[model samples]
Target: MKKSIALFIILISVFSLAFNSCSSDDDESNDPQVATGSFEIYLDGVLFKQGTNAEVGLIKDNQGNYVNTVTIGMGSETGIVVSGFPATISDVTTMDNDSDPGVNINVDSDYYGTISGTMTRTSASKISFDGTCTKLMEAQVYTITGFVQSTAWEVID
Candidate 1:
């Protein structure tokens, strides 16, 4: 009777361990990453600005293409604007600068450049992008690198 009781206790312990090992916590880490309405900009390999606010405007055309405009750090001196590019993305489309020349960048109303990299629509209301901007200011060339993950977007008529 003592040996049977010990064996029963051991089995229960094993079962408990097995149940706890397959928890939902492990599945949480496997979930897909989403945007959190934040962005970072680097100028010439140096940290320029970091912000937690973003605005995105999206418009869909008759042909089912999506046009998006994004603004980060709005109303601040260290702002960035992206327009005309990512012009044909859908809910899950990814586009690069090579295929889309319509992407323009304006920084602080002073630096102007064109974007070169990739922009992806992670969801219907979110986008993630990493790009380099070759800015020209007074005949001087500067490099600006940025990454944006916006949490929400508005559909425009």
Candidate 2:
């Protein structure tokens, strides 16, 4: 009986050790998560579509909503800065060297934003929003006025 008990405990410890070793706590980017959020679209300095761009914002906010803005470079004051580029930002680290805090910009410089949220193409060249942002039908829409694209929400997922 003592030998059986000892075997059982050893087996349990081995299982626990194996499970912990196999767990993926080492890599954050490679971690698989359900990507879901709102989206906005733009084309050639125009808001041709709001849901065209794949992946809008990173994740839901404190209020359980995804938000991001699509903007192009208008000058030194507008546009979105690519994640790696350094020249495309202001004093704020969140504010890329390109995208502005108050305006969506469309310039030649990397016309893209942070690739967050699950923006898999449910349809070719098309994207959809799911998860924490289902009721964002109205607030997450973008408006194209001539050469400018505008968003009302703080984030554009």
Candidate 3:
């Protein structure tokens, strides 16, 4: 009877160790993917901004819905940040970056205002962006366009 109890305890310990070792946080293949890429901005069909980096991510909201957030940071005092709540990969969502009807932007060392745009999730690992920003402070109206490639969510059968 003593031997049987000893054997049971050993088995339980081994199983616990095995399960703990199998758990991992380094694997993001099955998690929400984050993507970063480069983009260019054209000011009225002319090259105005270049070498800007764009980052995109999908996160869950308080309502358990996935939301899309995008930030484009151009060197200097220029940038465009937008977010769409409760968005999905198959839906096109509109973002008002400046808390109004436009996107958030900064220029000439100042936060100008917002721009209007559309965000599209092309695939599980890709997104497309299109927007028009009018920086009335700088007297410049430009179009912002770009795409980002995700980190590739993986699924284990």
TM per prediction? 0.46, 0.20, 0.46
Instruction: Give the local distance difference test score of model 2.
Output: 0.27
- Residue 38 error, candidate 2, Å: 3.1
- The global C-alpha lDDT for each of the candidates, from Candidate 1 onward, is 0.44, 0.27, 0.45
Q: Evaluated with lDDT, which candidate comes out highest? A: 3
**lDDT of candidate 2 over 17-60, digit per residue (tens):** 32333334535543212122233444333543332222222223
Residue 61 CA displacement from its true place in model 3, Å = 6.3
Q: Write the per-residue lDDT of candidate 1 for residues 1-157, one digit (tens) a residue.
A: 3532353344334333323343345454322211125667666778766777443333335695534554444333544444443423453233333223223334454544434555555454444545555443343434555555554343421
Candidate 1, residue 71: how far the Cα is off, in Å: 2.0
Error of 3 at 42 (Å): 2.4
In terms of TM-score, how similar is model 3 to the real structure? 0.46
Q: Encode model 3's per-residue lDDT on 1-157: one tens digit a residue.
A: 3532353344334333322332345365444333334545554567655442343333345785543543444333444444442235666767464433234444554443335677666666545556776544454756766554434211100
Candidate 2 deviant stretches above 4 angstroms: 1-34, 40-47, 56-99, 103-157
Off by over 4 Å in 1: 1-36, 54-66, 84-109, 122-131, 154-157
Residue 20, candidate 1: how far off, in angstroms? 53
